[model samples]
Target: MNTRCLVVCLAICAGPTFAQHIDIDPRKDVANLTGEQIYTQVCQGCHMPDAKGAVGAGRYPPLAGDVKLASGAYPAVMVMNGRGNMPAFGPMFTDAQIADVINYVRTHFGNAYTDSLEPDDVKVFRPPPPSNPPEKH
Candidate 1:
């Protein structure tokens, strides 16, 4: 077999194995990590290290110089509720983590937005937990 074919086979085989190694649980020790750390581990996969998003079958929308960051609430909502292909990090990250990443993205990557987001700010966007119905008599 040619080297190209062998490389392709190896890459395909590695995909699932690489994904399987990821920790799916969101409740890990993420609180102490910085926003840059959180973004590197989570958002950077799609948003890119530069935070200048990508496009394939879809546009990831560059976070750098994005006017949407003008309001801290906007990105917080997106992180929580998700938009388009971006998955919601609401369950995966603590409120502080969400705020950190939001603040990080807003301030870095050539973005000039100065507004800061606190965990309390993010909490506003989170959907209320479903209420349990009264037990049937």
Candidate 2:
């Protein structure tokens, strides 16, 4: 057999094995994480380790020295509902987690806004459940 054919055959055979080894649970609860922990685990992936944000295929507005974070509610609403290219994290994170991450970002990365957000504040921004439930066939 040609080397090209052998490589393709090996890849096809190994793909399922590699996939099966991945044990990530998308719904894993993160309710207990601290503000910093939540930011590191979730927000840093896009916003970056330094929280300076990034720009490429999409722009992640820099969290550092951002004037918008002067209003705690603004970041809270953005995290819960998302805007433009950002995805809504309301479904994945609890209200507390959302509040924590927002607070973390607001206070860190050269941002010094001091009014902290409580989980109650974040709860208000969460979208209400759908009025009509989808029926499962």
Candidate 3:
């Protein structure tokens, strides 16, 4: 096959894969951005622009007034560590960023939960330190 023809064929074959791919920004500084901005740029791809979630090959639960969000801790952990099909974003965002996004989701999309999370609150959910060998009692 000629190089030109091979390149064309590869492009045709790769088109669908690119179309189905969702781009999530890998930037680490989300603290300065508003919750809506973070959601629009990052979460919108999966959770959707409306924050209603989606279903197809996989299920994404809606964030609109979800009872699970009544506790800020639930969403904070999910955002930080990820759950099910969601990717872990803990390393990609600061505590303040995670808290801001969680707070946004909790308060928006018909969700009326009044609680707001702080960086300390998110820190508490982090995996605990490894325990030392128990001393003989």
Provide C-alpha RMSD values for all models, in order. Answer: 7.5, 9.8, 10.4
Model 3 alpha-carbon miss at residue 48, Å: 1.2
Candidate 2 clashing pairs, residues 3+ apart or interchain: none
User: TM-scores for all candidates?
Assistant: 0.78, 0.75, 0.70
lDDT of 1 by residue, 1-137 (tens): 22332332333335544333443222333446688887776677677778788776556778989998999999999989888777676876679989998999888999877778999999999999999999999
The digit string of per-residue lDDT tens for model 3 on 1-137 reads: 22332332333334445323423222323335677776776677667778788886567778886899999989988987888767676765678878888998888999998879999999877777689998998
lDDT of each: 0.73, 0.73, 0.71
TM-score: the better of candidates 1 and 2: 1
Clashes of each: 0, 0, 0
Compared to the true structure, candidate 1 yields what TM-score?
0.78
Please give the ranking of all candidate structures by TM-score, highest first, separated by commas: 1, 2, 3
Evaluated at residue 77, the lDDT of candidate 2 is 82
Candidate 2 lDDT over residue span 1-137, tens digit each: 22332332333335545323443233332446678976775677677789888876677778999999999899888888889867677776788888888888888999987888999999998888879878899
Poorest stretch of ten by lDDT in candidate 3:
22-31
